[model samples]
Structures are given as structure tokens and as C-alpha cells.
Target chain A: MRDEAALMRSARFRAEREQDWIKLEALVAKAERGGVQSLQFAEARDLASFYRQATTSLAIAREISLDKALLEYLEALAARAYLIVYAPQERLGGLIGRFFAASGPQAMRRSALFVAAGFLCMALGGLTGFLLYLESNDWYYVFMPSGLAAGRGPDASTEFLRSVIYDDSPAATGLGAFAAYLFSHNTRIAIFVFGLGVFACLPAILLTFYNGLIFGAFYALHVERGLGWDLGGWLSVHGVTELSAICIACGAGVQLGSAVLFPGQNTRKEALRLAGRDAVKLAIIAALMLFVAALLEGFARQLIQDAGARYLIGWGVGALWLAWFLLGGRSRR
Target chain B: MSLSRTRPTPNRQHRRNRRAARKKAASRVIPPEGVPLELPVASLGVRVAAQLTDLLITFAAAVSILILLSMLFFMYWSTVFALGALLFFFIRVPYYILSELVWNGQTLGKKLMKIKVVAHDGGSLTTHSLVLRNMMKEAEVFLPGTLLLTLDQTAPWAVWASLAWVAMAFAIPLSNPHRMRLGDMLAGTHVIRLPVPILLKDLAIEAPRAISANGQRFTFLPHQLDHYGGFELQTLEKLLRAQENRMSQSSAEQNRQAMTAIVERIRQKIGYADAVEPDDELVFLQAFYSAQRAHLEQRQLFGDRRANKFYADARPRGTG
Candidate 1:
């Protein structure tokens, strides 16, 4: 009687254990059927524990004449459960990382080019305005005020030039400094635009060319006048660095666009991310160049009066800008 | 116990039973794997990238239009080109709208990049969304707005005054959880990475590639099912129902052994001579069944042994 009772009890125990496993399997199937939510942290952890216990129970049940369907079912359940619970988040992380890696550098480079172009365009616009002023009937008055133009009144030109060079007011001095920062910031924006080309390269191109148009229009206004020589001397002092920054920004933008537009072996996102990574430093460098240009514009170009001295300052600044950009400290290209 | 009563009295019916269980499991799992493809999730990076790209592309278009207009004015053709620019305004917006609406939100440029614009729920983009996204182009002026001041002699400091406001307006996207710009939110559209196909046999135990904890149970429908006849399909399905019932009655260990035996029986009946050597019962069962289905399908259809092996080998274990 005891032997029969024990056998029955063991059978019942096995059946009960199987039933619990089945429940666990059903939960997993439900989760898999539902989506990734079926494998949340808590449920996945619970499933993991269930799998361990089930494995041991399964080993014990192996000695008896268990159903084959039950084993197959358990095996499938355990596999799915373990994958959801114990697998590291490497794939997701890797995917995101690759995406950034591919786009980041390219973005930075494009931004640098945009900044350069923006500065060049704007400076050229200023030159254009100067030329237009020269064409006016009171051309000399515009340059040095009425007194200086008359050549017999108080030398207010000296005072005005001095204030422009040395005054601490935001417009006279701070504007130059801010312009330097803007040059760099704009470059960075351009880089961001280009590096995100997987989304489309339109933004970078639009930004780069928009600045170009403004510069063209502004310069056209100046060229319409007769002060082209004076305008050239005034702008070249800062235009070199500013314009280079814009070009660098454009390059960065192109990098981003190409990354997305041509994601060779990588996904579009991955390519863009990689390009963005490379473009960041380029943007910083472009900003720094713009800052240097701002200092020259603030102190040297506006204040200087002797045409010869102005020409010399402009040449020196242009040389330095070219040397640094074309063959700089790092020579990244 | 009920499944046991329903089990075929003949041992030859065991292979048929296992096959049926596999089919039922497969039908449940196939959709999940491809779900990521059909319902793509737009990540923060993608959204940001999309916004930036849109900004650049629009800026380029604006610059081009301005240049074209300027050239027309310079050439004494202001009326013709100014009208052309105005025409572009009408044409450009609709071009983008039509492309996105008809081609799953893929603009020519986006299509080239293999990225597409989609709604938040991963559905098709709407016309309203297209208009909203494009209208945001007005905010994309690249010139430092100094020109606005330079042109507006009445408001000389307007450029400087509005600079801060412009900067602040552009900065809103930085705060968004999804890195969305105003246009993105208003349009209810986002950019997402497209799906790349994954091979079935490749989803094995590499530890790093593991999916859900209950990996074994996540069976998908194998492609081989297209070949089964109505009566054979019915027979296989009935056997699977019997297996599901029998599984409830047995201990886990006893269950594994029985499954292994059943797979072996199926291999023999299906005339899969090499499948008899059972290294891992589940693996053998999957490979053998897939191979048998392929072989049978080919014999009935193509009668080409070599061609059939290629399709059979391509069949993944327990996938839809």
C-alpha cells in the first residue's frame, strides 16, 4: 500500500512541477508574443529563477517515462527565458555608439566650414558697403566724418578711431569679441547640420550658402560704390580667418551628408554619428580662428588711419590665417 | 493523460505528432522578429539628425532661391525669376508632401540615405505633418540677421536686439526628451533607422546575441510550411495538439527523453538517414524536419535534389 501511495505521490509531484513549468512557459510565450515588454527586468529575473529550478526538476523527471512534448516545450521556454534575462545590453549600446561614432566627426568638420563661409560672406558684405559709401557724394565724410573730410575742422577722425579701437562699450569692443564667438558658434552649427546628413544634407548646404548669399549681397552693395580698395584693406585683416572657418564648417557639413547619403558598410545613423565625432574638434578650431579675426577687426582694421599701415596689418593677418588653416599645428586632414 | 489517449496507436504516428507541435509554436513567434522592422522606434539621435539635416537642406534651397532671384534681378529679368522663386515656394512644399505621403515618408534624399520620416507610432507621415515640417524652414535663416537691421534703417539695432531671441528659439530642441524640434513635434513625425535582415540559423548561442530568457519557446514559423498539403497539414496539426496535452502529464526529464525519441522516430519515417544520430534532440529535430519538408516539397515540385538542399539549409530552426 505504501509503495503504491509513494508512486502516486511522485507522479502527482511530477505533474504539479510540470504544471508550474507550463505556467512559466505560457508566461514567456505570452511575453514573446507581446513584444520586448514581455521581457522587462523583474519578469525576466523571475523567469531566470524559474528556468534554473525547472532544469533541476527536469533532470529528476528524466528517470521516469515523461512525455517528449513536455521536454521540447521546456527546452524552448528555457532558451527564450535565459536570453531575455541574462543577456547584456551590448547590442543596443553598440548600435547607438556606432551611430554616433559614424556621424560625430563629419558633423564637426562641416560646422567649421560653415563658420568660415559665414564670416567671409559677412566681411565681404561689409567691404561692399564701404565701396558703396565711396560712390556717394560725401564719400570722404563717411570715412572720417565732416570735420576730417573738410581738412580744416577738429580732427574728430582720430577720436572716433580711438574709441572704436579702445572703448570698452559692447558695440565698439564687445561686438568684435562677440563676433569672434559667433564665428565659432556658427561653425559648430554648420558641423551639426552636415553630420546629421543621414537625415538629409539639406540643412548644411542651406546654412552654408545662406551666409554666402548675405556676404555676396553685402559685398555687392559696397562694390557698387568706388571704395573697393579701402574695403579690401579693412576686411582682409579678419576675413581670412572668418572665411576659412566657414569653409571648414562646409567641409564638416559635407562629411555628415556623405555619411548618411553613403553609409557604405554601416547603417545611416552609424555613419552620421561617426562623422559627428570627427567634426567637433574641427568646429572648436574654427571658432578659435574666428576669435582671432574678431580681435583684429576690433583693434586694427577700424582704428588704423595710415593706408600703408592698414595694408601691412591686413597682409600680416591674412598670412597668419592662411598658414594656420592650411598647415596648422595638428594638420588633421 | 488525455493527449496520451489521443496519441496514435501506431508508433509511426510519433513523427507526425512532433511536426504538428512545431508548426503551432512557429505560427506564434514569426511576427515578433519582424515587428521591429514594420514598427521602427525613432531614437533621440535619429530625430536630432533628421532635424539638423532638414535645416541644412532647407538652408541650401533658400540660398539657391535667393541667388537665383538676385541673378534674375541683376540680369533685368526680376519679373521672370521673382515669379519663378514664388513658383518654387508652391512646388517645393508639395513635392516633399507628395513624396512622403506616397512613398512611406521617403524623400529622394532620404531614400538615398535609407532613412524615412515616420509618425511617432511608426506609421506613414500625414500631409499636415509635411506642411508643418516644411513651414519651419522660415526659422532657418543663416545670416546673422544683421542684414535685417542693415536694411531696416528705421530700426538700426533690431539685429542685435533680436539675436538673443533667435538663439533662444533655436535652443528649444536641446530640452526635448526625443531631441525634437518644434517642427518635429508639430508634424508628429520622426526619423528612424530601417530594418536589416537577420538570418535564422545565425540566431544561435553566442551569449552576446541572446534575446529573451525563454529562447526555446520563442519558435517562429519556418518558411517550409508553404509546401504542406491540406490533409498532411491537418494530420500534423492534430499530432501537435496531442503533444501539447501529453506534455502536461510528464516530468521535465521524462519529457526531454520522450521528445528526443519522438524526433528520432520522425527522422526515420521521413527517411532522413543522417538525422538519426541525435547530438541534441531539439537541434536534430529542427534540422531534420526542415530538411524533410524541403526534400518533400522539391520532389513534389521541382524534382531537383541539389536545389532543394539549398532551400532546406536556409530554413532556420523554430522561426516564422
Candidate 2:
């Protein structure tokens, strides 16, 4: 009860300063609504000074008086001012340029081991399937899912194989659905290869291998019918980007999966977070690659009949990808 | 596997935070390291709610699109169906990736929940981070959902694998201080609740004395003041404010009861002497306020605004 003089002093202080606070609050509201651009030079200066005064008032109000209303008003005002004044923004254009020109390639390079592991799985699986299918034709069915055959299983005759490959009619009905299905399937598989990499890349590696095995069985079946080069031309157009994208997706997954499994000196969560920065970049790039592959398969594959031109375009695209991965973003002195 | 214990309270979990803070303090140097700041992570419940909201929204969008497509291609039911499936799968791609991009890390659900995604390093959200996290969503969440819906009969192992993956998604966040799922972990992003702090309004009081009329303020030595830190100071400040308001209240007896409880707690906390009179609550509070304010202001000048007692004791040692 004897603290009455202190309470009077605090209330008196608030009465003296209340007008300035109301005026400043109005100014801050204007600034927030229209951005700092709405304020004149003098008004902006006044706002800054008011903010400083408000923060100081907050500190004083906290220690010297128990005026809870005044304290809260000042605290809220100060916090709002802090957020508005110190709002952080990064330049989108500059960051985008920097990321693609430097960070993306750097991340891909860092994930080389994962890419190699991915490629190794696919190549070994492909080799196994090629030999197994060459030994006997039933291995094709064993390698490929029966549901996924799309009428290319072992029962299909040599005539059917050659005719489908050469069928370049402009009027292709039901082909849109087929194209959509293929795109959906390929995208699903690519994403699948990347996603399952979280299991320390086991499932991803096996999937890449299984994909390659199916490809190998298909290749062997075509070769036995003396249409190996024709089929190569047919596939090569998009295979350049499609296959490499699969490798990239697998690599990105391995980057994440192994980071969790190993984690190096950091904790598992920390390691995964760091590796994720790289993995996401690679996965997106791989998705982009798949899109390009789909575009090529849809538009260009039907138009090109000569095996030589297909080989030229396909290998050329592959070389371009190699150059991109190796030399896209190296800074020059 | 039951995560009921780890759920977030509006106030950070007292028990977990206290233990972690203590461990952090015990391991830290006297000066502390990395600022030893405390930021609350969003709870699993809030995150799950946000996710479900997003799913409901996407489902509605897919359904609307399917209806339109079906009507447009009324003759081609199969095409309509396939396109619907494709849209269902992909509608989220633009919805999530673009919303987070344009809004700088808030999807509609996250925005509604007042939660936002921020970089793990406490930086601004980048396009790459958004893309990466959303892309990983294929594996982290959607794949499991898809497997559950389809349940491929030929691939029995796939069901178990999807279930395990989903289980890991729930399990992983429990292990870290930040409740980060796989996507969050990979994207190096975490969600934070943007709290607009609600201030507690103390009741009105008639003018009270600046200094007690009897000159009966409890005196304390510098060492006695040092016994309590900023955390206790803030608490005491709250107690004094409440008591100030209570002075004019109808329930004088209840006010006295509450004031005595607070005074007793403070006595035990700071090891104040047992010599203080029972009727001298106001005097003790007045004396402590002056002493603690002086202590804090002095520390502030030395650039040590110890926000709480935890800041005082958290000493960093070498770590793994």
C-alpha cells in the first residue's frame, strides 16, 4: 500500500508519453500497409526514433514499474517494429543464377559416388539379363513384369516387333493415352528410384538394376530377330537423357540414404539435412531430364526412321550432359 | 511408438526442455557457445493437422477436375479415368511447390496453422529447398499412401516396406529436438509457429507507494541479490504485478493466500533467510525488485542480458 507514490509516478509518465505512442503507432500502421515507401524522409526518421524510444520505454517499464498494460503495449509495438524493420529477403534472380551456375553442378559432383553405385547396379543387372535372355527366351518374361509388357513379351512374333518400331503413321489414336501412360510410368519409376534410396539405397539400387535388366532383355530379344540396330535407334533418341536421369535420381537418393546411415561427425539428423540440400537439387535436375526425355520420345522419335541419325542425336545429347555435369559451373579466375 | 508424451504444449514442454537445457548448460563453457538460444519446434499434432488440411484441399481439387474431365470426355470413360488418376497424383506438385515458392514457405494449410518452413541454418527459404522437400514428398508420404490404397497383390513385400517407411516418418521426429520428418530432414527445413505473444493484463489498482511509508524495505546484500537471476527476476516481477492488482480486489483473504504462496516459493528458490515477518510480504517484494533490477541493469551494461536462469548455468564443454 505504501508503493502508491511509485504507481502515481508510472501513471504520470504514461500520461505524458501516450500521445507520441498513439501518433507513432498510426505512422507504423501506414508504413506496414504501404511499405516504407509511403513515408517521407522526415516521417521515416521519426518512425526510427519512435521505435528506439518505444524499446527504451519497454526496458524501463519492465524494471521500474508494474504497469502491465503500458508494458504490454510497448512490448507488442517493439516486437512488431523489429519484424517490420529487420524483415530479411533474398534476391530471387541472383540466387537462382548462382544456384544453377554454381551450386547445382557442385552438388551433382559431390554425389558422384552415388551415381557410380547406381550405374554399377544397372550395368551388372543389364549384363546378367542379357546373358540369361540370350541363353533362353523365357528369361525375358522373368525379367519384365507381366503387367508392364505393353505387348512386348516373349510371345510376340518378329513381324510384330519390326512393324511396331516402323509404325510412323501421323494418325496415331489411343497413342495419347499410351504416351501419358509411358510418361506416368517412367516418372513414377524415376521418383521411385530416388525415394526408396532412403533405405540406404538398397531398393533404389535394385530398381535401377531391374530397369536395366528389362532393357537388356528387350535388346537381346530384338537382336535375335536381326533388328538390334533398328531398336537401338528407336530407343537411343530418349535413352540418352532418360537413362542418365535414372542414374542421377538413384545417386541423389543414395546421397540422402547414406548420409542417414553414416552421418559422419555430425548427428544423423544434421547429416541428413546437409546431404538433403544437395540431394534435392540433383533430384530436380533428374526430373527435368526425364521431362526432356519424354519430349524427345513423343515428338522426335516418331519422326526419325534412320538408325544413324538417331545414334548421332542420342550420343550428341549424352556428350552434352557429360559436359554439363563436368564443366557447367566452374568459376574462372 | 506411441508419441503421446512428445506432443507440444502452447508453452514448450517443461520437462524435456528443462532436461535439455540443463545438459546444454552442463556441457557448455561459462560464456556459452552458439548463443545457446531456445526456439520451440512445431508439434507433431499441428504438423499432422496441416498435412490433412492440404490432403483434403488437393482431394477436392482432384475431384472437381475429374468431374470436369469426365463431362468433357463423356464418351471416353477410360481416358477420363486415366487423366483423373494423373491429376490426382500431380495436383499437389504445383499446389505445394508454387505456394511455398510465392509465399516464401507457407502453403494454404501451413498458413492457416500459422506455421512456416524455414531453413535449418535459420536462413530464408530458397526455391531449391522447396523443390527438394516437395520432391522427397513422393517417397516420404505419398508413396506410402499410394501403396496402402493399391496394395499390389503380386508385391506383398511392398506393403510391409511402405508401412515401415510410414512408421519411420512418425518415428524419426521423436528422436530429434526438432520434430523433423524425412522430407524436412532432407530439405534442411523445419517448421516454426509464428506466435503473436498474448500479454496477461493485470487488474487495476489505486496509486501505491513508491517507497514504503515506514521505511520498512527489506535490505539485501549484493551476494543475496546474485542468488537469483533474470528468470527469477521476471517471475518476481509477475508476482509483484499480480499482488499490485490484487490490492484493490474484493477477495483480500484470497489475495493474501496467493501472495504468501509466491513469497514462500521465492524464499526456497533464492535461499532467503527465515527471519522475515509473515505480514511483511510487500516489504520483501519491494526490496527484492530494487535489488534484482540493479543486478540486471548492471549485467546489461556488461552485455550479459541473461534472459533466464538457464543462460546463467549453461556452460559448454567439448562435444561429439
Candidate 3:
């Protein structure tokens, strides 16, 4: 008789709760197949309530030593329900808006010290490269690759140097292609620099300095031809944005390296995780900046030949970026 | 359900214990209500398979786009090349991030593999986490992969550097219990295998009909039922369910032989003298299973909980 009673008790227990489990399972299945958007308002509310009830049933089942199969089913149901209920709800539009309005600029501001360090490294390298080139023109070949130098080396005549900067035919014919190529290439380099930052920031620093060396060498070649002022205007049209984007990318990488090297209060892993949040934001913003730079390089530099106007547009954009980074998301915070 | 307790040989018992031990380790996350839930981490092999599937899909898509663009802009080869580069990045990068975002951490490949990314802290899987993890994939997998493919063009020192980087990246996942790659560790996320829910009918209901169908009903006394516990009963329940599943003629013959062996062993353990007919083997087992389960449930209420048949010997000397 006792055996029969025990059997009946378990059977009754399952009978009482089976309906809820089946309902919850159906809801979970629908959500999995079609996402939370498929659910009606009432049905979504039902899902949450059913999830809580299932969790309670799981707890009860464990305490009372219900049949093993029933207990396992309840556990699985509860876990699935928990994941669905707690999933992030922000839409893509909202996420992108939030990033621009607050997260992106805020992250950049937070990592200013690292960005400064990155800039210092690049500037110092530029000085060293300029001085070496001044000492002797042999350093020019060491710094600039043949393909990149494009026949406008120290030996190039003044007229040739001027013609290269003032050239606008390529922009008319394939400006779109040029911009796309520059965007993709610069973005790849920026991302690569950010990624390699995991190895103690040394690689990022060296790469940034190397880039500065090439720029310095190129500038010295133009200066030798008495085209320094003209070249500055041509480059300033896009270089300000492009170089700053690279600097930001390097800073982001340095953030990761320092997080690993000196984790401070947190464990190394924890520090790296925290730093990744800000570093990713910085990296993304840097990529966007590179896109702008690419556009400027491909079109504005080609169309606008006036040196003074190019400087105005270039530094004007730079100043605007600085102000935006400083104040864009402060109100939201 | 057979009350005739089958004693597995020592070798089989050891193997079973080891199998149980090899079950995937679960990560515990505490929900808002404070109940800790165990989510099973996906195995390394499954994760690799899912990644390969995703990579193949992206590569195929990128190639198709490239071909279409080249065909449309045959006159402008440079434009086609530039567009192709942009298209590949768009397809590859957003394919991962957007798919995971929309599907709540599952891409097509992850969905096919029945795995998903979940937050380590049991919170919602935020957009930042998803993007961060996928971005790191470029560094961890794609960059090293491209380096390896272009090894002939690279300097010898570069080859060694990339090789070391790849090894370190691979070793990180292997060293961790959760098999978390660099992205997962940084993003505070890990992939988990979704459980396949089993909806078998209650085993208790199979007892009465099976017992009544046989001319000689197999019955067990209380003491005979006391030898085993809930764990053994559940294992028997699984075996019975497996037997009910349709199989080929050869497998059916093998199944019958295995059941006969179990019946013989069970009878020996319980010291039952009566011979159970061959056709009634399943019926006898079902009857024994229900009786043993009921007996275990009653003892459990009295705080004399037995985990398995081995519990009797494992108990303290005084308790036995």
C-alpha cells in the first residue's frame, strides 16, 4: 500500500506541473525559432512568469528527490528559459546611437594618457628621422621604399615634385576606387596595430615610430626641393586625420599591453577584460576616422589645390574632432 | 525495473565510473533568484567544427561577391578590386557580429552545431561583448592564418614569430578548463552546448501492463528491492527506453542477448530461483524497475538515501 501511495504521489506531482513545463517549452521553442519579436506582448509576459515557476519547480524537485528524469527535464527547461529571458534587448539602431552619443568619445577620453604616449613616440621618431636625413641623404633610401617614394626622391626636380602633389587626373577617373582602397588598407593596419598591442605595447610603439620615420623622410625630400610649404598643405588635407587615427589605434593597443603588464588591483586576466571594453571602442572610432581621412585624401586634396585652404580644411576638421571627443558624450554621462 | 539486482562486473563498474567522470564540466552561474545553474561548456572539437563551417561559408560568399562585381565592372578592374576588398570585410566582419547579435549569440554555424555564446557572469550578452570577441578573432585566427598561407613570401624570422604566436593562441584555449579562446576570455563569454530535451513517457506506467501480460508475474520482496537505489533505477530506466527504440534485426538479437545477461545477473544477485521465460524478459525487467523505484523513494523519505547499489558497501561500518 505504501508503495502504491509513493507511486501515486510522484504521478500526481508530475501531473500538477506538467502543463506549465509543456507551455514553457513551447514558448521557448517559438522564441528560439523566431526570436523574442515573434512573441505577443501577453505571450512574453507569460514566458517570464512561466520561467519563474519552472525555476521554483526545479528547486522543489531537487529538494523532494523527484524522479531523476523529471528533475533533469526541469533543470534543462529552467536554464533555457533563463537565457532567453535575460538576453540583451537593445536594437541595433539604439546600440549605434548609444555608441556615438556616449560610449565612443567617453572611451577615447578615458585612454588619453595612452594616446599621448603614442603621439610622443611618433613625434620623437619623426625628429630623429628628419635629423638623420639632414645629416646625409642616404637615410632616405633606408626609410622610403621605392614603390612608396614613386620617383620623387631627393634627386627629383622641383617641377616634378610640384606636379606630383598637384596631380588631379587619378581623382577624376578612379576617386571612388582610390578612397575604398585607402579606407580598407588603413583600417586593416589600424586593427592590426591594436591587436598586436597584447604583447606588451612594444610592437605598437615600434610600428608607430616606423610610420613616423617614413613621413619625416618624405617631408625632408620635399623640403630639399623647396616644396616643403606646398607639401605640408597637400598632406594636411588628410594627414592630420589619418595620422591621428593611427595614433589612436596605437593607444588602444597600448591600453591592452599595459593592462596585461600592470594589472594593478585586479588579476591580469580581469584587467585585460576591463581594458578590452574601452580599447574596442577606441579601435572602432579610429577606423571611422580613417574612413574620413580616406575620403579627404581621395577627393578634397585632389580638387582643392590652394595650400592655405587645404590647411584650413585639415586643421578645421582636426579641431572639430578634438571638440567632439571632449564634449560629445559628456552631457549623457 | 527488475528487482533482481544485477551486479555489474568490477571492470564494467570501473568503466562506468570513468565515463561519468568524463562528462563535460559545467560552469555555474547564479541567476537573480540566487539559484546556481550549471551550463555545459562546449567541447573543443565542436567549437573547431563550428568555426570551420563559418569560415567556409564566409569564404564562399566573398568569392561569389567578387565574381559578380568583376563581371559587372569588367571595364574598371581597379574599381572591381577595391569593391571586392570592401565587400569581403563587410561580409566577414558583420556576418559574425550581426548574426550573433540578432540570434542572441548564435551564428548559422553555431546554430547548426547547437552551441551558443553566453555571458560568463550570467548577465545578458551585451553588444560590446559580441563585437569585441569577433574583432579579436581577426588577431587570433585570421591574421595568423593569412601569415601562414603567405609564409613563402615572408622572411624566416617572420615565419617563426607567427608560428610562436599561433602556438600561444592555441595553447591558451587548451590550458583553460572552459576551453576559452582569447576572444572569449577577453569578452567574458564562453560557448555552451544546448541540452537536447528527452521526453520519454514515465517508466512507472510501463510496469502494470507488462506484469499483467505475462502468465508468471515476477515479484520482488522488500529486502530484494532494498539492494539498489535511485541511480541504478534510472540507469535501468534508460536501458529499457533504449530497448524500446526501433533497431535492425541484428541489433535486436544483440539487445536480447544483453537483456538476458542482465536478467541472469540480477537473479543471481537477488537469489531468485525461478527461471524467467525468454519472451517475458522485458516484462520482468519493467516490473522489477517499478518496484525497486518505489522502494528507493520510501527509504529516501526516511533519510536512508542510497545513491547506487555500491552504497551499501561504501557506508561506514556501524551504519551497515
Candidate 4:
């Protein structure tokens, strides 16, 4: 039989030199994992020697060896699980999340203010376009591509304008066409606003205000020309959803821009990361609204040429939108 | 014939020795696997998910806040009111509460996600930790952005430098084991996995008694030895008798002989055979030695084949 004392001496001797072996073992394990550079055969043998010495001491003392491969494999599995859980839903969530994160209370207040401002500007823009229509004594020419004016001036209201909005083609594609155009346009606008955040929202603010004023001008012109009811019914059909989307885009843009400008307690980079998240969410919601608006404007509104029917549709969409924005969303969580 | 016989004998003994060593390395005293170790810092993926979730919740929360703030701002900016009423509760309150609560605390996202917050020492988070973590947000998110926003077409060098600085600060967690952010380090708070439910009552037994390798009676706690001033042969005779009474079989008798030889060797080495009997300290030491020696002898005879070479080489020349 082997001497028990000699065995104990060997175990103790191995324990004394366990540290070098552990390092070598770790190096070899890492090299085998392919995350490290190459090693010589001598290095590999040295690592093996260290592993043997450590294993011997542990067997004598603590009675265990760590399983390096199992630990790494488990870590990798955990990382992959995280990616699955957090990544998929993030696409839309990220868009809207940024707007909320950037503004907090500010986003809500700015949105409300912008909504009111949008109404005013749209009415104003409509009014200017109406004035231009009346000046040329060509109210029906406003919607015509041929009669459209140069520069930023409003186009004359042409016969084509009213006819096209209300007309049904053989393909019956007015609703789908308008919906596609409106949805794509709104999404583009929202993204543009969000991207322009690099400029601290100078471009976004100008864009929002320009659209708002144009809308206001359009509304004012009709009201002044004794075409208030006709215009109101026409605008309300698609206007509620379309305009709501524009407002949302502006909200997202403001959020992105504000993070850059006021980053306040947050670092500018961190704030941008946050703002970017919220803006994306808002942009998606805007796209959904635009889709609904275009369907109403091109199909439902155009078919219901009766002033009263148009008025009712407009009021219904407007009320629904109002409820969505204002009193409808009450802490569902 | 001697070489063939000796070769198999040594190979069997060597295999037994190596097997014993490997088993000792894998056992941990306390089982930590099932217990939830608090997560100090989440990886990058978790951080991004949390940020995204907070944004949506904040947007809803922000609407009300923004409305009030805008009213106040409009009143002041438009000069419509004699005095501007800045309702701190509307804007600042939610901002402070939500950032600390959701971003650092329990943002709706985190609440839905099943994670929690704690100090680095594994204590409940304090108010100071919350404020400090949120306050550093400006440095984390905005200052560097201002340079990019303002100097877009000009001072490319300055913009790049500022961006690099910001990235470095954000990447600080990557370099540390704990993955602490600037605020987390300063406040000594950590985001961790919530404690999972566990039932200890389900265990049938805790810490069962140890059994001797030779099937002899064994006691974990030390006690006074009954026999005193006994010679090595006398103790072995007593142990053999006691063991015979406890176990019945030819194998038991053979194991007893092996154990006796191992114990006598240990007793001779420690120079404790001359000591008087019934020494509690000696008995305890003897018990440990007995267990170790028995295990080693069994391993030498029946363990890994490669390990027996040491003993084979140590034998007298031409012993085979």
C-alpha cells in the first residue's frame, strides 16, 4: 500500500502551487473557446499541469473543480433569452417610448398646446387659400394641378378640386389611394421630425407651424366665403385623423428636440436615447391615425355629399379623436 | 508473468486513486444554485428594454403634466396673468417621481418585467440613491448632444471628441464586474433580480450523519475515548471487536484488517499511541485520520490506473 503520509505530502505540495495551475487552466479554456489568440503546445501543457495540480489539491482539501464550459454555456443561453424577450416588441415600443421619456409632463402639455395651435394654423392656412381662391374668381380651381399658384401662395379653388375629392373612379380606389398616401405621408413627417432632432428641433418646429398655419388659413377662408358648412364637413371627414397624426408627429419631434436642448438632469446623449425611444412610439400611433383618416376622407366623406351627413361624420371622428387624446386614456394600468 | 501481473495490479490501483481526487473537487459546502443571487447590473439588452418601456409610460404620464406646465408657461410667456403659477406638482413632481420610480425604481416597464432595486450592499434603496441616479441623467444624455445639435456643420473635431467622451462614460459599466453606472457607483445602489419563492420545508433531511468507509461506527462530534493508555494493538483489537458486533460478513472482516493497518500507521506517525486513552482531542484527530486513510487505501487498490505508477516505482528494485 502507498504511504498515507507521502500522499498527504504530495497533496500539500500541489496545493502550494495551485494558483499557477488555475491561471493556466483558465488560459487554456479561454484559448479553446476561440475568443483568445493562439497558444504554443508548451503553454497548453503548462495549463494542463496547472489544472492537474489544482485538481489534486482540491480533491484533498475542498473536494471540487469548477466547470468552466458549463458556466459559459449557461451565460450564453441567458443572453440569447434576453434578446428574445426584449427585442421583438421593441420596434413599435421604442418609437413611442422616446416621446414620453423625453418630455415626461412636458410632452402632454406641449401636445395639448400644439393641438390647439394646429387648429388655429389650419384655419388660418385655409383662410389664405380661400382668399386666393376668391381673388381670382376661381374658387373651384384650388384643387386643380394646372391652376395651382407659384411660390408659397395658395392655389385658386378650381372645379377640379371639389370634383376630385368627391368623385369615385371606376376602380373605386379613392379610399385606398388616399389612405395609403396619408399613412405614408404622416409616417414620413413623423420620422423627419424625429430625425431633425439633431438640429435641436429648429426644423421640426418650423414644419409643425407651417402645416398648422396652412390648415388655419384654409379653414378661415371657407368660413369667410360663406362656405363654412361645406368646408367644415369636408375637412372633418379625413381632417380629424390626418390632422391628429400631424399633431402626434409634432409631439414626437418636440420630444426629440427638447431632449437635445433641455437634457436637464439627463446627459444629452442619454436624453437623446430616451427621446428617440418615445418619438418612435408616437410616430407609429400617428401612422395608425393617418390610415383611419385617409379612409374616411376619400371614401366615406366623398360618398356622403349631403352637407348634414358630412357634418355628422366630421363631428363623430373629431369627438372620437378628442376622447382618445383628452378624457379617454385614464390610467388603464 | 510477474511483469504482466504487476502491470494490471498497478493500473487498477492508479485508476482508483485518480477517481477519488476528482470527486472531491466538485462539491460546494452550501448549495447556492437555486437561491436567487441578486443581479447587480443587467447586461446591455436589459438596459435598452427598460429605457424603451419607461418612455411609453412616461408619455402617458407626461400628457397631464405637460398640459399644466403649458398653461403655466403660456400664462407667463403670454403675460396673460398677473402672476405665473408654476405648478411644481404637475411637471417636476412626476418627472422626479417617474424617473426615480420607473427609470431607477419601478418604472411601469420594470414592474411588468419582474426586477427590483437595491443598494450595492443588498439593502433597500434610499432616497439619496434615487435622486443621485436621476440627477446624473443630464450628463448621461444631454450635454454632449448640445454640441452635436449646435455644431453640426462646423467644428467636426469638437463634435467627434464630445461624442467619444459621452460614449466612454456610457460604456463605463462594461469595464467593471458590477456594471455600475456613474450614479449607481456614487449612490451605491444596484438593480437586481427579485427574490424567487423557495420552500425549505420540502427537504426530507438536512445534514445526515456521515458513514465510515470501512462500515465501522462513526461519530461526527468528538467525544471522550473510552479506552485510555492503550497500545496500538490493543486499540485495534477493541475496534475490531466493536465493528464485528455491528457488521456481519467476510468482506467486513477484510475491510477491518485494512482499516487497522491504516490506523496503526497514522497512530505511529502522530506519536499519539503512547498517549493515555480517552483523550477527546486525540480521538477526534484519530477519527479524521482514520477516514482519510481508509479512503486513500481503497483508492490505491481500486482507483485510476495511471495514479498507481507512483507506488509501483517506489517499490524495491526487482520486487516484481
Number of clashing pairs per prediction, in order: 98, 17, 5, 87
Share of native interface contacts present in candidate 1 = 0.00
Which is better, 2 or 4, measured by lDDT? 2
Candidate 1: which stretches are off by over 4 Å?
A: A1-171, A174-199, A326-333, B1-320
Tens digit of lDDT per residue, candidate 4, span B1-320?
Answer: 46565555777878877754543321111111221121324555676577567655554555566567566554233222111112221333346444443333555556566554455543344554554455444334444554455444534764785577578656876655455565455455545443222111100011122333433333422222211211332343334334425566887667656665554554555444333223232333445433333343334344312122254454468644
Off by over 4 Å in 3: A1-10, A63-68, A145-147, A152-159, A171-176, A183-185, B1-24, B48-75, B143-171, B209-219, B229-231, B298-305, B312-320
Best by TM-score: 3
Residues B163-194 of candidate 3 have per-residue lDDT tens digits of 88788888888777677888888899988888
Which prediction has more favorable lDDT, 1 or 3?
3
What tens-digit string does per-residue lDDT give for candidate 1 at A1-333? 122212332234455676567666765665545533556687766676676766555444433312233334444554344333322222334533543343333444335554454445445544554454445534333333222123411233444433333334444333434333343334444433433322455655555554554444333433444343555555566665666666665555566566668879986545654554444345445545665765766566656655567768777776865554444334355
Candidate with more favorable, higher TM-score: 1 or 3: 3
| TM-score of the first chain in candidate 2 relative to the native first chain | 0.81
Over A147-175, each residue of candidate 4 has an lDDT whose tens digit, in order, gives 12222223435444445435545344453
**Cα RMSD over interface residues, candidate 2:** 6.5
Better of 1 and 3 by DockQ: 3
Give the winner by lDDT: 3
In candidate 3, the residue pairs with backbone N, CA or C atoms under 3 Å apart (3 or more residues apart, or in different chains) clash, namely: B1-B288, B1-B289, B2-B288, B2-B289, B3-B288
Candidate 3, B289: how far from true, in Å? 1.8
TM-score of each: 0.31, 0.71, 0.87, 0.36
